[model samples]
Target: MDTGASEVAHDFRPFFRVYKDGRVEKYKLIDHVRPVPAGLDPATGIETKDVVVSPETGVSARIFARTAGGGGGGPDRKLPLLVHYHGGGFCAGSPFDSTSNGFLSAMVTQANVVAISIDYRLAPENPLPIAYEDSFAALKWIAGHSDGSGPEPWLNQYADLGRVFIVGESAGANIGQYVAVRAGVAGIRVKGMLVVHPFFGGKETDEMYKFMCPTSSGLDDDPKLNPAVDPDLPKMACEKVLVCVAEKDWLRNRGVKYYEALCGSGWEGKAELVEAKEEAHCFHLFTKSERAEQLIKKMVDFITMD
Candidate 1:
């Protein structure tokens, strides 16, 4: 059998449209929105639901949840929950189309837990904390409220709050890390955070030049520094953080610096850095690479362990 990577190519897919030359071009993820109606099992496939998680700027922001299994209980009663944030360089991408959500759902199936992929607001049009605020709000809602109106009816029936975990890829990982730091300071009891191929503060380095100078993708360049978030938040938060980076990724050095910064802050958390050999940024989302698959299993085990 071929490993996922053996069968997959370099994945640089996007989830939003880039408007230039008066023409709108659809991205890889945008085409995947509102997937085929999914049911309760793998045979029925995954279901995508677009629901408004909250409102920002007086307008509602929506998230699409790809849910499978973990309904009414058998042996997996009170199952664990994984909430995911998709990667689009903080500019574009949807939980519905991200390949990570599918792989994460497989993890949910194996762990007998529920996984949620949040569709937060994107950048340029929305910008900065708009995405962060939306994702953080969604997480807060998961911890404090469950409307039972989400994709998983069984989640409310059997979710194990004690085992709740959070995950994000690429830019999403940064958002996840920030969320964990904030939650820690606020005294919120979340199980753990899984940050894959995260992009830390580019504003602190020359890396912003690579992303902005030519502006190959204006979306990637714009959010390199969002003035909305307090710069001091990193020092105040991010003590015990879990950070993973692809060796070949442009953001690898930044991820390491972020880890070092957190460790230096004397915060009371562990920093786990896993290397993805020969991989690029957002490598884990492809789920087709042998290394990526192995890393996913490793991360699941780490976050799930007490």
Candidate 2:
């Protein structure tokens, strides 16, 4: 990910620039930032607000929930909490845009759950474990509100900390799994995990991951990237897990393999695998079709189910 070269050098432009002396320049998310709809969607009764997750690192998140007295958040006073992670290939992507905001808003109206879309630090500039660390820090910050005495009145008023779901898409899926694994060691309570097209590396080292995390020990050995080799996979602490993979996605095999490994690892939990026929990676986030609806509906049923 740096430029103090000794062997192979990486320069994945349009995403990042690696200069001499190990300085890396990253491109901003301008395209995704634009065309965003302003403020809450009153029609859906969904309201979103941004909060500082870690002020020191500029890490923040967009919190989504149905406003009080709104008809969208279901009949329950306290709803299941969904701590979500957006996918951007670990370099760029966010929950602040129109697409992500709209999606979260829809989830709010449909599933009636309070969602926290984390905006963790990206890589090349910050690197792999840094993103992971910052994500876990956000989770810890959220955990502090479990007592209902912590900051954030919305969480205190709406979120059911006992029934929490860690959900992610693509790279965010990878991060979600990491958080779930670390939560087990940290003793944090997480009900389940829903990962969509998880961004896991293959047998051959992934160039993207290598460029983002130059120090990583390839895909095969890094438990952070390869959960198949992660010993803690069986001790994930969560009660259940749902892994969704698209048939046409190159990572589909890996996601399927993960489900197989999880089931055979004696994880002692319910594991669900979903495949979107003839679909490509992260298609549900784009094409607003019946297939996408079905996928999101599956996710909603999983989150709202007992």
Highest-TM-score candidate: 2
Q: Write the per-residue lDDT of candidate 1 for residues 1-306, one digit (tens) a residue.
A: 535423322222453333333223335553443443334334534343444555443323222222434342423455666778777677666665536546656666555456667877765455456777777777776665343444434445555555667778777877787676566666666676776777654544433222223442323233332212434334333333467888899888777766676656555666687788988877555547788778877776775666
Give Cα distance to truth, residue 122, candidate 1, Å. Answer: 1.4
TM-scores of the candidates in the order shown: 0.71, 0.90
Writing each residue's lDDT as its tens digit, candidate 2 over 71-98 gives 3244356788899988877888888876
Please list all clashing residue pairs in model 2, or write none if there are none: none
Candidate 1 Cα errors over 4 Å, as ranges: 1-38, 44-51, 55-76, 146-155, 203-240
lDDT of each: 0.58, 0.82
The C-alpha RMSD in Å for every predicted model, in order, reads 9.2, 3.6
Q: Count the backbone clashes (under 3 Å) in each candidate.
A: 5, 0
